[model samples]
Target: MADGVPMVATLAAKTMEVPGVHTLSLALDTHSPFDFDYGQFNMLYLFGAGEVAISIMGWHQGLLQHTIRAVGRVTRPLVALEVGQQLGLRGPFGRGWPLAQLRGRDLVFITAGLGCAPVVAAIHHAVANRDQYGRIVILQGVKHHADLLWQTQYRRWQALGECQVLLAASEEHRHRHHWRLGLVTELLALAEFDADHCAVMMCGPEIMMLAALKQLARLKVADEAVYMSLERNFQCGRGLCGHCQLGPYFVCKDGPVFHYPQVKPWLGREGV
Candidate 1:
Protein backbone atom coordinates (compact mmCIF):
# COMPACT_ATOMS: atom_id res chain seq x y z
CA MET A 1 0.00 0.00 0.00
CA ALA A 2 1.17 3.51 -0.72
CA ASP A 3 1.79 6.08 2.00
CA GLY A 4 -1.29 8.27 1.54
CA VAL A 5 -3.72 6.11 -0.38
CA PRO A 6 -6.83 5.19 1.53
CA MET A 7 -7.71 1.54 1.23
CA VAL A 8 -11.34 0.90 1.98
CA ALA A 9 -11.79 -1.95 4.42
CA THR A 10 -15.04 -3.52 5.57
CA LEU A 11 -15.80 -3.95 9.23
CA ALA A 12 -16.19 -7.72 9.39
CA ALA A 13 -16.83 -8.11 13.11
CA LYS A 14 -17.23 -6.21 16.35
CA THR A 15 -16.66 -7.06 20.03
CA MET A 16 -17.31 -4.87 23.01
CA GLU A 17 -19.29 -4.29 26.22
CA VAL A 18 -17.97 -0.97 27.44
CA PRO A 19 -19.67 2.19 26.22
CA GLY A 20 -16.76 3.67 24.29
CA VAL A 21 -14.16 0.97 23.65
CA HIS A 22 -14.40 -1.36 20.66
CA THR A 23 -12.52 -4.30 19.17
CA LEU A 24 -13.11 -4.33 15.46
CA SER A 25 -12.12 -6.88 12.86
CA LEU A 26 -11.70 -5.27 9.45
CA ALA A 27 -11.07 -7.03 6.20
CA LEU A 28 -9.95 -5.34 3.04
CA ASP A 29 -13.09 -4.67 1.06
CA THR A 30 -11.24 -5.89 -1.99
CA HIS A 31 -10.55 -9.16 -0.20
CA SER A 32 -6.77 -8.62 0.02
CA PRO A 33 -4.40 -9.37 2.84
CA PHE A 34 -3.33 -6.80 5.45
CA ASP A 35 0.12 -7.75 6.66
CA PHE A 36 1.96 -5.81 9.34
CA ASP A 37 4.58 -6.23 12.01
CA TYR A 38 3.80 -6.12 15.69
CA GLY A 39 3.72 -2.58 17.23
CA GLN A 40 2.90 -0.77 14.00
CA PHE A 41 -0.26 1.38 13.76
CA ASN A 42 -2.65 2.29 10.98
CA MET A 43 -4.33 5.57 10.14
CA LEU A 44 -8.03 4.86 10.09
CA TYR A 45 -10.46 7.24 8.40
CA LEU A 46 -14.21 7.36 8.54
CA PHE A 47 -15.36 9.24 5.45
CA GLY A 48 -16.65 12.45 7.04
CA ALA A 49 -15.05 12.06 10.46
CA GLY A 50 -11.31 12.03 9.52
CA GLU A 51 -8.72 9.54 10.84
CA VAL A 52 -6.91 8.40 13.92
CA ALA A 53 -3.96 6.16 14.64
CA ILE A 54 -4.82 2.72 15.96
CA SER A 55 -2.40 -0.03 16.92
CA ILE A 56 -2.64 -3.28 15.02
CA MET A 57 -3.92 -5.84 17.46
CA GLY A 58 -3.87 -9.49 16.35
CA TRP A 59 -5.30 -10.88 13.17
CA HIS A 60 -7.81 -13.69 13.28
CA GLN A 61 -7.71 -15.92 10.22
CA GLY A 62 -7.37 -13.14 7.58
CA LEU A 63 -9.06 -10.16 9.24
CA LEU A 64 -7.08 -7.33 10.79
CA GLN A 65 -8.13 -6.24 14.27
CA HIS A 66 -7.74 -3.04 16.25
CA THR A 67 -8.81 -2.17 19.78
CA ILE A 68 -10.03 1.43 19.76
CA ARG A 69 -11.23 3.55 22.64
CA ALA A 70 -13.33 6.60 21.85
CA VAL A 71 -11.29 9.55 22.95
CA GLY A 72 -11.61 12.12 20.19
CA ARG A 73 -13.92 13.39 17.50
CA VAL A 74 -12.72 10.78 15.03
CA THR A 75 -12.66 7.86 17.44
CA ARG A 76 -16.12 8.49 18.86
CA PRO A 77 -17.66 7.74 15.50
CA LEU A 78 -15.22 4.89 14.91
CA VAL A 79 -16.34 3.04 18.04
CA ALA A 80 -19.95 3.51 17.02
CA LEU A 81 -19.38 1.91 13.64
CA GLU A 82 -21.32 -1.25 12.89
CA VAL A 83 -20.42 -4.41 11.04
CA GLY A 84 -20.46 -4.24 7.20
CA GLN A 85 -19.47 -0.59 7.31
CA GLN A 86 -16.41 0.62 5.41
CA LEU A 87 -13.59 2.83 6.57
CA GLY A 88 -10.30 4.03 5.15
CA LEU A 89 -6.93 2.61 6.26
CA ARG A 90 -3.54 4.05 5.33
CA GLY A 91 -0.90 2.08 7.23
CA PRO A 92 0.81 -0.74 8.77
CA PHE A 93 3.18 2.18 9.46
CA GLY A 94 5.99 2.83 11.98
CA ARG A 95 8.62 0.52 13.50
CA GLY A 96 7.77 -2.58 15.45
CA TRP A 97 9.08 -4.41 18.55
CA PRO A 98 12.59 -5.80 18.19
CA LEU A 99 11.40 -9.39 18.09
CA ALA A 100 14.28 -10.41 15.84
CA GLN A 101 16.92 -9.13 18.28
CA LEU A 102 15.05 -10.61 21.24
CA ARG A 103 15.44 -14.21 20.10
CA GLY A 104 17.00 -16.68 22.54
CA ARG A 105 16.69 -14.15 25.36
CA ASP A 106 14.15 -13.82 28.12
CA LEU A 107 11.23 -11.59 27.07
CA VAL A 108 9.30 -9.30 29.37
CA PHE A 109 6.29 -7.28 28.26
CA ILE A 110 4.93 -4.65 30.63
CA THR A 111 1.77 -2.93 29.47
CA ALA A 112 -1.12 -1.00 31.00
CA GLY A 113 -4.76 -0.86 29.87
CA LEU A 114 -5.18 -0.51 26.12
CA GLY A 115 -1.44 -0.76 25.71
CA CYS A 116 -1.88 -4.52 25.36
CA ALA A 117 -3.25 -4.07 21.85
CA PRO A 118 0.09 -3.03 20.45
CA VAL A 119 1.96 -6.01 21.90
CA VAL A 120 -0.54 -8.76 21.20
CA ALA A 121 1.18 -9.55 17.92
CA ALA A 122 4.53 -9.85 19.66
CA ILE A 123 3.10 -12.32 22.16
CA HIS A 124 1.81 -14.45 19.34
CA HIS A 125 5.14 -14.21 17.59
CA ALA A 126 6.91 -15.43 20.72
CA VAL A 127 4.53 -18.35 21.11
CA ALA A 128 4.90 -19.34 17.48
CA ASN A 129 8.65 -19.43 18.05
CA ARG A 130 8.44 -20.57 21.65
CA ASP A 131 11.80 -22.32 21.62
CA GLN A 132 13.60 -19.15 20.61
CA TYR A 133 13.12 -17.46 23.98
CA GLY A 134 13.95 -18.44 27.53
CA ARG A 135 10.90 -17.29 29.47
CA ILE A 136 8.01 -15.09 28.31
CA VAL A 137 6.50 -12.83 30.94
CA ILE A 138 3.55 -10.46 30.47
CA LEU A 139 2.50 -7.96 33.14
CA GLN A 140 -0.70 -5.99 32.46
CA GLY A 141 -2.53 -3.35 34.49
CA VAL A 142 -5.85 -1.58 34.19
CA LYS A 143 -7.94 0.80 36.29
CA HIS A 144 -10.65 -1.71 37.22
CA HIS A 145 -11.57 -5.29 36.42
CA ALA A 146 -14.16 -4.03 33.95
CA ASP A 147 -11.36 -2.26 32.08
CA LEU A 148 -9.62 -5.51 31.15
CA LEU A 149 -9.79 -6.01 27.38
CA TRP A 150 -9.08 -9.61 26.39
CA GLN A 151 -9.94 -11.68 29.44
CA THR A 152 -10.06 -15.12 27.82
CA GLN A 153 -7.07 -14.51 25.58
CA TYR A 154 -4.82 -14.20 28.60
CA ARG A 155 -5.57 -17.78 29.53
CA ARG A 156 -4.62 -18.93 26.03
CA TRP A 157 -1.32 -17.09 26.36
CA GLN A 158 -0.69 -18.65 29.77
CA ALA A 159 -1.27 -22.11 28.39
CA LEU A 160 2.06 -21.87 26.65
CA GLY A 161 4.62 -23.32 29.05
CA GLU A 162 7.21 -20.66 28.35
CA CYS A 163 4.85 -17.82 29.10
CA GLN A 164 3.56 -16.31 32.35
CA VAL A 165 0.77 -13.71 32.57
CA LEU A 166 0.07 -11.55 35.61
CA LEU A 167 -2.61 -8.89 35.96
CA ALA A 168 -3.16 -5.97 38.33
CA ALA A 169 -5.68 -3.19 38.77
CA SER A 170 -5.23 0.19 40.37
CA GLU A 171 -8.86 0.20 41.47
CA GLU A 172 -10.04 -3.15 42.79
CA HIS A 173 -13.26 -4.76 41.58
CA ARG A 174 -15.30 -7.44 43.29
CA HIS A 175 -15.00 -10.20 40.65
CA ARG A 176 -11.26 -10.43 41.17
CA HIS A 177 -10.02 -14.01 41.18
CA HIS A 178 -6.28 -14.38 40.72
CA TRP A 179 -5.80 -10.67 40.00
CA ARG A 180 -3.58 -8.71 42.34
CA LEU A 181 -4.91 -5.36 43.50
CA GLY A 182 -2.30 -2.59 43.30
CA LEU A 183 -0.09 -0.70 40.91
CA VAL A 184 1.35 -2.65 37.97
CA THR A 185 4.81 -1.93 39.31
CA GLU A 186 3.89 -4.16 42.26
CA LEU A 187 3.92 -7.12 39.89
CA LEU A 188 7.37 -6.06 38.73
CA ALA A 189 8.52 -6.34 42.32
CA LEU A 190 7.57 -10.01 42.34
CA ALA A 191 8.82 -10.76 38.82
CA GLU A 192 11.95 -12.90 38.57
CA PHE A 193 13.51 -12.17 35.16
CA ASP A 194 17.27 -11.80 34.95
CA ALA A 195 17.72 -8.13 34.10
CA ASP A 196 20.90 -8.84 32.18
CA HIS A 197 19.38 -11.55 30.01
CA CYS A 198 15.93 -10.16 29.36
CA ALA A 199 14.64 -7.69 26.78
CA VAL A 200 11.90 -5.51 28.27
CA MET A 201 9.23 -3.88 26.11
CA MET A 202 6.81 -1.49 27.80
CA CYS A 203 3.86 0.68 26.74
CA GLY A 204 0.97 2.61 28.28
CA PRO A 205 0.60 6.02 29.81
CA GLU A 206 3.97 7.81 30.01
CA ILE A 207 3.66 7.71 33.77
CA MET A 208 3.17 3.98 33.81
CA MET A 209 6.23 3.43 31.65
CA LEU A 210 8.25 5.74 33.87
CA ALA A 211 7.12 3.88 36.97
CA ALA A 212 8.00 0.53 35.40
CA LEU A 213 11.42 1.83 34.42
CA LYS A 214 12.08 2.84 38.00
CA GLN A 215 11.23 -0.65 39.18
CA LEU A 216 13.35 -2.19 36.41
CA ALA A 217 16.21 0.02 37.51
CA ARG A 218 16.03 -1.59 40.98
CA LEU A 219 16.25 -4.91 39.17
CA LYS A 220 19.33 -3.72 37.24
CA VAL A 221 17.89 -4.01 33.74
CA ALA A 222 20.25 -2.36 31.29
CA ASP A 223 18.97 0.80 29.64
CA GLU A 224 19.89 -0.65 26.26
CA ALA A 225 17.83 -3.80 26.80
CA VAL A 226 14.71 -1.80 27.57
CA TYR A 227 12.33 -0.51 24.87
CA MET A 228 9.12 1.51 24.81
CA SER A 229 6.42 2.65 22.41
CA LEU A 230 6.08 6.40 22.64
CA GLU A 231 2.79 8.03 21.69
CA ARG A 232 2.86 11.54 20.27
CA ASN A 233 0.63 13.70 18.10
CA PHE A 234 1.26 12.27 14.67
CA GLN A 235 -0.50 13.92 11.76
CA CYS A 236 1.35 12.33 8.90
CA GLY A 237 2.68 8.80 9.10
CA ARG A 238 5.91 9.93 7.45
CA GLY A 239 8.24 12.50 9.02
CA LEU A 240 6.79 15.40 7.02
CA CYS A 241 4.44 16.44 9.79
CA GLY A 242 6.12 17.78 12.89
CA HIS A 243 3.23 16.88 15.19
CA CYS A 244 4.97 13.71 16.34
CA GLN A 245 8.40 15.26 16.78
CA LEU A 246 10.40 14.35 19.87
CA GLY A 247 13.72 16.15 20.24
CA PRO A 248 15.60 15.18 17.07
CA TYR A 249 13.21 12.40 16.07
CA PHE A 250 9.80 12.04 14.43
CA VAL A 251 7.95 9.39 16.43
CA CYS A 252 6.01 8.25 13.38
CA LYS A 253 9.10 7.75 11.23
CA ASP A 254 11.79 7.03 13.78
CA GLY A 255 9.71 5.41 16.45
CA PRO A 256 6.54 4.46 18.13
CA VAL A 257 9.11 1.87 19.30
CA PHE A 258 12.48 3.03 20.65
CA HIS A 259 15.20 1.92 23.05
CA TYR A 260 14.83 3.37 26.52
CA PRO A 261 18.24 5.06 26.41
CA GLN A 262 17.44 6.83 23.17
CA VAL A 263 14.56 8.64 24.85
CA LYS A 264 15.85 8.88 28.42
CA PRO A 265 17.20 12.40 28.05
CA TRP A 266 13.78 13.76 27.16
CA LEU A 267 11.60 11.56 29.33
CA GLY A 268 10.07 14.02 31.79
CA ARG A 269 11.09 17.13 29.98
CA GLU A 270 8.35 19.52 28.94
CA GLY A 271 7.78 20.22 25.24
CA VAL A 272 10.60 18.59 23.35
Candidate 2:
Protein backbone atom coordinates (compact mmCIF):
# COMPACT_ATOMS: atom_id res chain seq x y z
CA MET A 1 0.00 0.00 0.00
CA ALA A 2 1.11 3.55 -0.67
CA ASP A 3 2.04 5.78 2.26
CA GLY A 4 -0.62 8.36 1.39
CA VAL A 5 -3.42 5.91 0.83
CA PRO A 6 -5.58 4.95 3.78
CA MET A 7 -5.83 1.26 4.60
CA VAL A 8 -8.84 -0.46 6.11
CA ALA A 9 -8.63 -1.19 9.80
CA THR A 10 -11.18 -2.59 12.23
CA LEU A 11 -11.64 -1.41 15.80
CA ALA A 12 -10.78 -4.57 17.72
CA ALA A 13 -10.91 -3.21 21.25
CA LYS A 14 -11.26 -0.02 23.30
CA THR A 15 -10.05 0.66 26.83
CA MET A 16 -11.03 3.82 28.65
CA GLU A 17 -8.01 5.29 30.36
CA VAL A 18 -9.59 8.36 31.95
CA PRO A 19 -12.53 10.66 31.37
CA GLY A 20 -12.51 11.64 27.67
CA VAL A 21 -9.46 9.46 26.92
CA HIS A 22 -9.43 6.00 25.35
CA THR A 23 -6.97 3.46 24.02
CA LEU A 24 -8.16 2.05 20.73
CA SER A 25 -6.79 -1.19 19.30
CA LEU A 26 -7.21 -1.39 15.54
CA ALA A 27 -6.64 -4.51 13.49
CA LEU A 28 -5.58 -3.79 9.96
CA ASP A 29 -7.36 -5.62 7.17
CA THR A 30 -4.15 -6.70 5.52
CA HIS A 31 -2.51 -9.99 6.31
CA SER A 32 0.99 -8.49 6.12
CA PRO A 33 2.66 -7.29 9.30
CA PHE A 34 2.46 -3.65 10.36
CA ASP A 35 5.31 -2.21 12.37
CA PHE A 36 6.08 1.25 13.73
CA ASP A 37 8.72 2.80 15.89
CA TYR A 38 7.93 4.41 19.21
CA GLY A 39 6.98 8.14 18.88
CA GLN A 40 5.61 7.74 15.34
CA PHE A 41 2.01 8.76 14.60
CA ASN A 42 -0.74 7.65 12.25
CA MET A 43 -3.45 9.54 10.43
CA LEU A 44 -6.78 7.92 11.36
CA TYR A 45 -9.67 8.68 9.04
CA LEU A 46 -13.34 8.49 10.02
CA PHE A 47 -14.80 8.63 6.50
CA GLY A 48 -16.89 11.87 6.51
CA ALA A 49 -15.60 13.12 9.83
CA GLY A 50 -12.02 13.73 8.60
CA GLU A 51 -8.71 12.53 10.06
CA VAL A 52 -6.42 13.35 12.98
CA ALA A 53 -2.79 12.64 13.81
CA ILE A 54 -2.45 10.29 16.81
CA SER A 55 0.67 8.81 18.35
CA ILE A 56 1.26 5.07 18.20
CA MET A 57 1.08 3.62 21.73
CA GLY A 58 2.43 0.19 20.70
CA TRP A 59 1.13 -3.11 19.39
CA HIS A 60 -0.52 -6.14 20.99
CA GLN A 61 -1.33 -9.46 19.30
CA GLY A 62 -0.76 -7.74 15.94
CA LEU A 63 -3.28 -5.02 16.85
CA LEU A 64 -2.20 -1.38 16.54
CA GLN A 65 -2.82 0.68 19.69
CA HIS A 66 -3.41 4.41 19.85
CA THR A 67 -4.27 6.36 23.00
CA ILE A 68 -6.46 9.29 22.02
CA ARG A 69 -7.98 12.15 23.95
CA ALA A 70 -11.52 12.98 22.75
CA VAL A 71 -10.98 16.69 22.35
CA GLY A 72 -11.49 17.34 18.65
CA ARG A 73 -13.92 16.72 15.82
CA VAL A 74 -12.21 13.59 14.51
CA THR A 75 -10.82 12.32 17.78
CA ARG A 76 -14.15 12.51 19.63
CA PRO A 77 -15.71 10.21 17.08
CA LEU A 78 -12.64 8.02 16.79
CA VAL A 79 -12.71 7.24 20.51
CA ALA A 80 -16.47 6.67 20.46
CA LEU A 81 -16.10 3.99 17.81
CA GLU A 82 -17.44 0.58 18.78
CA VAL A 83 -15.59 -2.69 18.45
CA GLY A 84 -15.80 -4.25 14.96
CA GLN A 85 -16.34 -0.82 13.38
CA GLN A 86 -13.93 0.05 10.58
CA LEU A 87 -11.87 3.14 9.77
CA GLY A 88 -9.04 4.26 7.50
CA LEU A 89 -5.41 4.32 8.56
CA ARG A 90 -2.54 6.03 6.74
CA GLY A 91 1.03 5.65 7.90
CA PRO A 92 3.05 4.76 10.93
CA PHE A 93 4.62 8.14 10.23
CA GLY A 94 7.38 10.47 11.39
CA ARG A 95 10.71 9.94 13.14
CA GLY A 96 10.92 7.99 16.39
CA TRP A 97 13.02 7.83 19.57
CA PRO A 98 16.74 6.95 19.23
CA LEU A 99 16.62 4.03 21.61
CA ALA A 100 19.26 2.09 19.64
CA GLN A 101 21.82 4.88 19.90
CA LEU A 102 21.35 5.39 23.63
CA ARG A 103 21.93 1.80 24.64
CA GLY A 104 23.87 1.31 27.92
CA ARG A 105 22.95 4.84 29.08
CA ASP A 106 20.37 5.90 31.60
CA LEU A 107 16.94 7.00 30.27
CA VAL A 108 14.94 9.85 31.81
CA PHE A 109 11.41 10.32 30.50
CA ILE A 110 9.55 13.56 31.19
CA THR A 111 6.03 14.03 30.02
CA ALA A 112 2.92 16.04 30.92
CA GLY A 113 -0.75 15.52 30.21
CA LEU A 114 -1.75 13.20 27.34
CA GLY A 115 1.56 13.78 25.63
CA CYS A 116 2.85 10.76 27.50
CA ALA A 117 1.32 8.50 24.86
CA PRO A 118 4.21 9.01 22.43
CA VAL A 119 6.84 7.98 24.97
CA VAL A 120 5.02 5.13 26.67
CA ALA A 121 6.11 2.51 24.15
CA ALA A 122 9.73 3.52 24.45
CA ILE A 123 9.56 3.08 28.21
CA HIS A 124 8.12 -0.38 27.78
CA HIS A 125 10.96 -1.33 25.41
CA ALA A 126 13.53 -0.15 27.94
CA VAL A 127 11.90 -2.08 30.75
CA ALA A 128 11.65 -5.29 28.75
CA ASN A 129 15.35 -5.06 27.94
CA ARG A 130 16.38 -3.80 31.36
CA ASP A 131 19.87 -5.24 31.38
CA GLN A 132 20.90 -3.28 28.28
CA TYR A 133 20.33 0.09 29.96
CA GLY A 134 21.53 1.77 33.10
CA ARG A 135 18.72 3.36 35.12
CA ILE A 136 15.12 4.16 34.10
CA VAL A 137 13.48 7.28 35.52
CA ILE A 138 9.92 8.22 34.58
CA LEU A 139 8.34 11.57 35.48
CA GLN A 140 4.82 12.58 34.54
CA GLY A 141 2.51 15.47 35.49
CA VAL A 142 -1.19 16.10 35.18
CA LYS A 143 -3.74 18.66 36.32
CA HIS A 144 -5.24 16.21 38.82
CA HIS A 145 -4.41 12.83 40.28
CA ALA A 146 -7.31 11.24 38.43
CA ASP A 147 -6.06 12.70 35.15
CA LEU A 148 -3.03 10.44 35.21
CA LEU A 149 -3.64 7.79 32.56
CA TRP A 150 -2.17 4.28 32.87
CA GLN A 151 -1.90 4.59 36.64
CA THR A 152 -1.60 0.83 36.97
CA GLN A 153 1.26 0.63 34.43
CA TYR A 154 3.23 3.28 36.29
CA ARG A 155 2.80 1.37 39.54
CA ARG A 156 3.93 -1.86 37.88
CA TRP A 157 7.07 -0.17 36.57
CA GLN A 158 7.73 1.25 40.02
CA ALA A 159 7.48 -2.20 41.52
CA LEU A 160 10.25 -3.38 39.18
CA GLY A 161 12.69 -2.20 41.90
CA GLU A 162 15.02 -0.73 39.29
CA CYS A 163 12.73 1.76 37.52
CA GLN A 164 11.96 5.07 39.27
CA VAL A 165 8.50 6.48 38.62
CA LEU A 166 7.46 9.88 39.99
CA LEU A 167 4.12 11.54 39.40
CA ALA A 168 2.94 15.10 40.19
CA ALA A 169 -0.48 16.69 40.19
CA SER A 170 -0.38 20.44 39.76
CA GLU A 171 -3.97 21.29 40.71
CA GLU A 172 -4.60 18.82 43.48
CA HIS A 173 -5.19 20.14 46.99
CA ARG A 174 -5.38 16.71 48.56
CA HIS A 175 -2.34 14.46 48.66
CA ARG A 176 -2.06 10.78 47.89
CA HIS A 177 0.79 8.94 49.53
CA HIS A 178 2.12 7.92 46.15
CA TRP A 179 1.80 11.32 44.45
CA ARG A 180 3.57 14.64 44.95
CA LEU A 181 1.48 17.83 45.02
CA GLY A 182 3.34 20.12 42.66
CA LEU A 183 4.56 20.58 39.11
CA VAL A 184 6.18 17.60 37.36
CA THR A 185 9.43 19.50 37.16
CA GLU A 186 9.55 19.48 40.96
CA LEU A 187 9.75 15.71 40.88
CA LEU A 188 13.01 16.00 38.94
CA ALA A 189 14.79 16.82 42.18
CA LEU A 190 13.81 13.46 43.57
CA ALA A 191 14.41 11.47 40.32
CA GLU A 192 17.61 9.44 40.18
CA PHE A 193 19.56 9.46 36.91
CA ASP A 194 23.00 10.50 35.75
CA ALA A 195 22.37 13.75 33.93
CA ASP A 196 25.70 13.61 32.13
CA HIS A 197 25.30 10.03 31.00
CA CYS A 198 21.58 9.81 30.36
CA ALA A 199 19.28 10.46 27.42
CA VAL A 200 16.09 12.44 28.08
CA MET A 201 12.87 12.03 26.12
CA MET A 202 10.20 14.70 26.64
CA CYS A 203 6.72 15.39 25.34
CA GLY A 204 3.79 17.68 26.19
CA PRO A 205 2.88 21.33 25.76
CA GLU A 206 5.68 23.49 24.36
CA ILE A 207 5.85 25.50 27.58
CA MET A 208 6.29 22.43 29.74
CA MET A 209 9.10 20.99 27.60
CA LEU A 210 10.87 24.34 27.53
CA ALA A 211 10.75 24.50 31.31
CA ALA A 212 12.15 20.99 31.50
CA LEU A 213 15.02 21.89 29.18
CA LYS A 214 16.00 24.61 31.59
CA GLN A 215 15.94 22.21 34.51
CA LEU A 216 17.95 19.64 32.58
CA ALA A 217 20.57 22.24 31.72
CA ARG A 218 20.95 23.10 35.41
CA LEU A 219 21.74 19.47 36.06
CA LYS A 220 24.41 19.46 33.30
CA VAL A 221 22.42 17.38 30.80
CA ALA A 222 23.70 18.40 27.38
CA ASP A 223 21.20 19.71 24.88
CA GLU A 224 22.37 17.07 22.41
CA ALA A 225 21.46 14.33 24.84
CA VAL A 226 17.76 15.25 24.93
CA TYR A 227 14.97 14.52 22.45
CA MET A 228 11.41 15.88 22.23
CA SER A 229 8.18 14.97 20.47
CA LEU A 230 6.51 18.09 19.11
CA GLU A 231 2.89 18.71 18.19
CA ARG A 232 1.45 20.98 15.49
CA ASN A 233 -1.45 21.31 13.07
CA PHE A 234 -0.78 18.10 11.19
CA GLN A 235 -3.57 18.30 8.67
CA CYS A 236 -1.70 15.91 6.41
CA GLY A 237 0.70 13.13 7.32
CA ARG A 238 3.04 14.32 4.58
CA GLY A 239 4.98 17.60 4.47
CA LEU A 240 3.37 18.83 1.24
CA CYS A 241 0.45 20.27 3.21
CA GLY A 242 2.77 22.58 5.16
CA HIS A 243 0.37 22.60 8.10
CA CYS A 244 2.90 21.19 10.55
CA GLN A 245 5.90 23.33 9.73
CA LEU A 246 8.41 24.65 12.23
CA GLY A 247 11.02 26.86 10.60
CA PRO A 248 12.56 24.85 7.73
CA TYR A 249 11.26 21.51 8.97
CA PHE A 250 7.84 19.88 9.06
CA VAL A 251 6.69 18.16 12.24
CA CYS A 252 4.92 15.44 10.25
CA LYS A 253 7.89 14.78 7.99
CA ASP A 254 11.12 15.95 9.56
CA GLY A 255 9.91 14.94 12.98
CA PRO A 256 7.38 14.69 15.70
CA VAL A 257 10.57 13.58 17.49
CA PHE A 258 13.80 15.64 17.24
CA HIS A 259 16.99 16.09 19.14
CA TYR A 260 16.88 19.09 21.50
CA PRO A 261 19.58 20.99 19.63
CA GLN A 262 17.69 20.66 16.32
CA VAL A 263 14.65 22.62 17.53
CA LYS A 264 16.11 24.86 20.22
CA PRO A 265 15.60 28.09 18.27
CA TRP A 266 11.88 27.55 17.79
CA LEU A 267 11.01 25.72 20.98
CA GLY A 268 9.04 28.42 22.78
CA ARG A 269 8.59 30.96 20.05
CA GLU A 270 5.23 32.70 19.77
CA GLY A 271 4.89 31.90 16.09
CA VAL A 272 6.90 29.96 13.57
lDDT of 2: 0.92
Span of ten consecutive residues with least summed lDDT in model 1: 172-181
Tens digit per residue, CA lDDT, model 1, 1-272? 78789898889999884657898999886666677889999999998988888999877888989999989889989988889999999888999998999888899999998888898889888988888898889899988877888778787886767677888988975354547888777898767677889999988999999989888888999899999999988788878878998888889988899998998998878878
lDDT scores of the candidates, listed in order? 0.86, 0.92
> Residue 12 CA error for candidate 1 (Å)?
1.0
What is the per-residue lDDT of model 2 for residues 1-272, given as tens digits with 9 covering 90 to 100?
Answer: 79889999999999999989999999999988888899999999999899999999999899999999999789999998999999999998999999999999999999999989999999999999999999999999999889989988998998997799889999982365558998888888888999889999999998888888888889889999999999999888888899988988999999999998999988777878
Estimated TM-score per prediction? 0.95, 0.98
Error of 2 at 258 (Å): 0.4
Q: Which stretches of candidate 1 lie over 4 Å from their true place?
A: 173-177
